[model samples]
Target: MDLLANLVLGFEAALTLQNLGYATLGVVLGTAIGVLPGLGPVPTIAMLLPLTYALPPESAVIMLAGIFYGSQYGGSTTSILVNIPGESSSVVTCLDGHKMARNGQAGLALATAALSSFFAGCVATVLLAAFAPTLASVAFKFGPAEYFSLMVLGLLGAVALAHGSVLHAICMILFGILLGLVGTDITSGGQRFTMGFSELFDGIEFVALAMGLFGLAEVISNAGRQDDRQLVTKKLSGLWPSRADLRRMTAPAVRGTALGSLLGLLPGGGATLSSFAAYALEKKVSKRPRDFGTGVLEGVAAPEAANNAAAQTSFIPMLTLGMPSNAVMALMIGALMLHNIQPGPQVITNNPQLFWGLVASMWIGNVILVVLNLPMIFVWVKMLSIPYRYLFPSIILISCVGVFSVTNDVFGVFLMAAFGAIGYILLRLDCEVAPMLLGFVLGQSLEAYFRRAMLISDGSLWVFVERPLSAAMLILAATIVMTFFIPTLTRKRTEVFREAE
Candidate 1:
C-alpha cells in the first residue's frame, strides 16, 4: 500500500508538463546520437553535462536517464539498416540484424529490436522500483568498514570484467587512483602532489577528465575513419511481427531480461556486457547454433532485450547505495553531486519525490522511445547519410564550450587538452580507459571510508575482518583477484573477449 501511494506521488510529479517535455527531448536527442555510428551515450552525456545545470534536479535526471536508455532503442536501428552499431551494446545486434536486413527483413529485424527493448525496459523498471528501497534499507546498516570493503570489491569487479588484459586494467586503475590523489589532502590541510600550482590544489576537474578521456579523445580517434555504409531500405514495411516470430522472441527475451537485471547490479556490468553475454547465451542454448549469425529472430530479440534491461537496472546501485556500477553511472553520480544531492540510502528517505519521480520518468521514457523509434525510423536513417567528418568538428566545439562553462577559466580548457592527448595515446595503446574513469570517480570515497573506519576502530585493522558483511566483501574481492592469477581463467577470459571482438 505504501508502495502504491509513493508510486501515485511519483506519477503526480513526473506527469507535469515540464518533466514530460524534458523526457521527450532527451529521448529524441538520445535516439539521434544513437543513430550516428561510432557515437555512444557516455561521451554525449559528458558533453551535455553542463546543460543540465539549467534544469531542476528532477528534470535534469529524468532527461539524462532518458538519454541513457533511449539510446539502446536507437542503436539497433543502425545495426540492422546500415550494419553499423551506434552504441557498443548494439554490437551483438549487428551479427543477426544486418543479415536480416540484407535478406530484405529489415523491418522485421527493427521491429523485433524495438518491441524486445520496450518489454525488457518495462520489466527492468518494475524490478528497480520494487527492489531499490529494499537494498537501500540494507545500506542503512552499513558502517564505514562495509563501505570500504564494498568499494574494494567494486574496483576489483571492474578489472575482472574489463575487455582486455587484466594487468593493463589494473595499471589503469592505479594510474586513475594516483591522479585522484594529486590534490590537497582533505584531512591534513596540506597538498600532496599539487606541484605549486594553485589550480592543482583543488584537484583535476571530473568534467574535464570525462571530456578529454571520452569526448575529445574519441573525436581524435574517429577522425580518420570513413562511414561506408549503404542502407538496406529507406522505407520499412511489415511493421508487425508474424505470430511465428513472436513465439521465437518470447523465451530469449525473457532469458535476456533476467540476465541483464542480475548482471546490471554488479560493478562494471552494464548494457554492453549484458548484450554480449545474452547473445552468447542464446547461441549456446540454441537447437542449431549455426543459425545465430544468419538472421535468426532470437539474435535480434535477446541482445536488444538484454542491453535495454541492463541500461535500466544498472541504476539500482547508484540510486540506492551511491556506488556506480559503470562509467555512465559514475557520471550520473557527478550530476547528482552538482545539485548538492548526495546519492545514497538517505536519498529515498530524504527525497522520496525525487527518487520516485525518477523511477516514474523511466517508465514514461520507454513508451516515448517505442513511439518515436517506429514512426521516425526514416528520419534516423537519413541522419546516417551525414559524413563522420562533419560531426567531429561540431562535437569538439560543443565539448570545449561545455568544459569552459564550468568555471569560466581557460585553465580548464588547457587541462582538457592535455587529457585529450593522453586519452588518444592510451587508445592507441589498446588500453580500456573505462576502469580508469571508475577508479578516479570512486577513489576519494574509498579513501574516505577506509580512513573513517580506521579512526573509529582506534587504529585496529581487525575491524574490517570482524564485521561479517565487510569480511564477506573482502573475501569476494580477494577471490576475484586470485582468479586472474590462475592460468585457466586468464586464458578463458582472453578467449571470451577475443570472441566478442
Candidate 2:
C-alpha cells in the first residue's frame, strides 16, 4: 500500500508536461546514438552531460536515465541489421541476430529484440522499486571499515569477470587507481602527483577521460580498419513474429529477466555481464544446444531481455548505497553530486520527489522506446548507410567541444587527446577498459574509508578484521582473488612438465 502511494506520487511528478518532454527527447536521442556503430551509452552520456547543466536536477537525471536504458533497446537493431553491435552488451546478439537477418528473418529478429526488451524493462523497474529501499536500509548499517572492504570485494569481482587475463585486468585497475590519485589529498591538503600542473590539483576530468577513451579512441581505431560497408536487408518481411517464434522465445525471456535482475544487484555486474551470462545459461539449459548459434529466436530474445533488465536494475546500488556498479552509474553519481544532492539512504527520505520521479520516469521511458523503435526501424536503417568518413569528423568535433565546454579550458581538450592515444594503445593490447574505469571511480571513496577506519581504530591495522561485516567482505575478496590464480598455477606447472618430457 505504501508502495502504491509512493508510485502515485511519482506518476504525478513525472507526468508533468515538461518532464514528459524531456523523457521523449532523451529516448529519441538515445535510440539514435545506440543505432550508430561504436557509440555506446558511456560515451553518449558523457558527451551529452554538459547539456544537462541547463536543466533542473530531476529532469536532467530523468533524461540521462532514459538514455542509459534506451540504448539497450536500440543496440540490437545494428546487431541484427548490420552485424555490428552498437553497445558491448549487444555483442552476443550479433551472433544469432545477424544470422537471422541473413536467413531473411530480419523483421522477426528486430521484433523479438524490441518486445523482449520491453517486457524485461517493465519487470526490472518493479524489482528496482521494491528492492532499493530495503538495500538502503541495510546500507545505513555500514561503517567506514565495512565500506572499504565492500569496495575491495567489488574490485576483485570486476577483475574476476573482466575479459582476458586476470593479470592484465589487475594491472589496468592499478593504473586507474594511480591516475585517480593525481590530485590534492583530501585529508592532508597536499598535492601528491600533480607534477607542477595547476589543473592536476582538481584531479583528472572524468568527462575528458570518458570521451577520450570511448569516443575518440573508438573513432581512431575504426578509421584504421579496412572499410567494408555494412550489408543491411532491403526488405524487412513481417513486422510481427509468428506464434511459433513467440513460443520459442517466451521461456527464455522469462528466465533471462530473472537472471539479469539478480546479477544487476551484484557489485560490478551490469548489462554486458548479464547478457553474456544469459546466453551461456540458455545454451546450458537448451535440450538442443547445438542449435544456439544457428539463428534461433531464443538466442536473440534471451540476451536482449537480459541486457535491458540489467541496465535498469543496475541503478539500484547507485541510488540506494551510492556505489556505482559500472561507468554509467559512476556518471550518474557525478550528476547527483553536481546537483549538491548526495545519493544514499537519505535520498529517498529527503528528496522523495526526485527518487519517485526518476523511478516513474523509467516506466514512461521504456514505453516511449518501444513505440519509437518499432515504427522508426527504417529511419535507423537509413542512418547506417551514412559512410564512416563523413561521420568520424563530426564525432571528433563534438567530443572535443563537449570536453572543452565542461571545464571552459583547452587543457581538458589536450587531456582528452592524450587519453585517446592511451586508450588506442590499450585497445591494441586487448586490455579491458571497464575494470579500469570501475577502479578509478571507486579509488577516492576507498581511500577515504580506509583512512577513516584507521583513524577510528587509532591506527590499528586489525580494525578491518575486527569488524564482522568488514572481515567477511575481505574474506570474500581474498577467496575470489585466489580462485583466479590457483587454476593458472596448476596449468603452468603441467605445461612445464610437458615441455620437459
Candidate 3:
C-alpha cells in the first residue's frame, strides 16, 4: 500500500510540465551526443553541470539521470552503423552489431538493440525502486568504522575490476587521494598542499578536474587522429523485427537484464562491465557459440539489454549509500552537493519526492527513448557524416565556457587546461582514469571516517576489526587484493620453473 502511494506521488512530481520538458530535452541531447563518436556520458554530464544550477533540484536530477541512461540507447547506433562505439559500454556491440549492419540486417539489428534496451530499462527501474529502500535500511545501521571499512571495500573492488595492471590502478588511486588532499584540512584548521594558491584552498574544482580529464582531454586526443569511420551507407529496411527474430532474442534479453541488474549493484560495476560480461556469458551458454562473432541477433540483443539494465541499476549505490559506483555517479554526487542535498540513506525519508520522482522519470525517459530513437535513426546516420574537425572545436568551446561559468573565474579555465594536459599524458600512458576519479570523490569522506573511528577507539587500530560488519568488509578487501597477487605469483613461478628446465 505504501509503495503504491509513494509511486503515485512520484508520478505526480514527474508528470509536471517542467519536469517532463527537461526529461525530454535531456534524452534528446543525450542521444545526439551518444550518436557522436568519442563523446560519452562522463564528459557530456561534466560539460553540462553548470546548466543544472538554474533549475530546481528535482528537475536537474531528472534531466541528468535521463542523459545517463539515454546515452545507452544511443550508443548502439554508432556501434552498429559505423563500427565505432559512441561510448565504452557499446564497444562489445560493435563485435556483432556492425557485422549485422554489413550483412544488410541493419534495421533488424537496430530494432533488436532498441527493444532489448527498453525491456532492460523497465526491469532495472523496477529493481531499483524495490531494492533501494531495503539497501538504505541496511546502510542506516553503519557506524563511522563500518562506513570507513565499506569505503575500503569499494575502492578495492574498483581496483580489482579495473582493466590493466592492478598495480597501476592502485598507483592512480593513491595519486588521486594525494590530489584530493591538496586543500585545507577539515579537522585541523590548517592548509596542507595549497602551494600558496587560494584556488587550492577549496581543493580542486571537481567540474574543472572532470571537464579537463574527460571532456578536454578527449578533444585533444581526437584532434590528432584522422577520421577513418566508414558509415553504413546501405539502405536500412523496415525497423520492426520479424516474429522469428523476436523469438530468438527474448531469452537472451531476459538473461542479460538479470545479469546486468545484479552486476550494476556492485561497487565499480556499470554498463561497460555488464555489457562485456553479458556478451561473454551468452557466448559461453549458446549452443551455436561459433556464430557469435558472425553477427548473431543474440549477440546484439544480450549486450544491448545488459548495458541499459546496468546503466539504470547503477544508481542504487549512489542513492542508497551515497557511494559512487562509477565516474558518472561521482559527478551525480557533485550535482547533488551543488543543490545542498546530501546523498545517502536519509534522502529517501527526507526527500521522498526527489528520490521517487527520479525513479518515475526513468520509466518515462525509457519510453521516450524508444519513441525518439526509432524514427531518428536516419537523422543520427546523417549526423555521422559531419566532419570531426567542426565537431571537436564546438565541443572544446562549450566545455571551456561551461567550466568558466562554474565560478565566472578564468582560473578555472586555466585549471581545466592544465588538467587536460595531465589527462592527455595519463591517456598516453594507458592509465584508467575511472578509479582515480572514484578515489578523489571518496577521499575526504574516507579520511573523515578514519579520523572519527580512531577518535572513538582512542587511537586503537583494532577498532576496524572489532566490529562485525567492519571486520567482514576489511576481510573482503584483503581477499580481493590477494586474488590479484596470487595469479601473478603462480605465473611467475611457472616461468621460473621453465627457465630452470
lDDT of each: 0.90, 0.85, 0.89
Best-first order by lDDT: 1, 3, 2
Give the local distance difference test score of model 3: 0.89
Given candidate 3, what's the lDDT at residue 203? 90
Candidate 1 lDDT at 79 equals 90
In model 1, residue pairs whose N, Cα or C atoms come closer than 3 Å (at least 3 residues apart or on different chains), thus clashing, are none
Error of 2 at 431 (Å): 1.8
lDDT of 2 by residue, 1-501 (tens): 989999998888899998899989888888877887767788778777667766788898899999888888888999999888887788889989999999999999999999999999999999988988888889889999998998889888777766666788899888888888889998999998899999889899887887788778888888855545476687887879889888889999998999988887777788887888899899999998999888988899999999999999989988987777887887887778667788777888888888899899999999998888888999988887777788789888988988888889999999999989988899889887777777877788889999999999999989999999999999999988788768776465344323222
Task: Give the number of the best model, judged by lDDT.
Answer: 1
Pitting candidate 2 against candidate 3, the one with the higher lDDT is 3
Per-residue alpha-carbon lDDT of candidate 3 for residues 293-346, written as tens digits (9 for 90 to 100) = 789999999989999999999899999999988889989998888788888999
Clashes of 2: 0
| Every model: Cα RMSD to truth | 1.1, 4.0, 3.8
What root-mean-square deviation over C-alphas does model 1 reach? 1.1
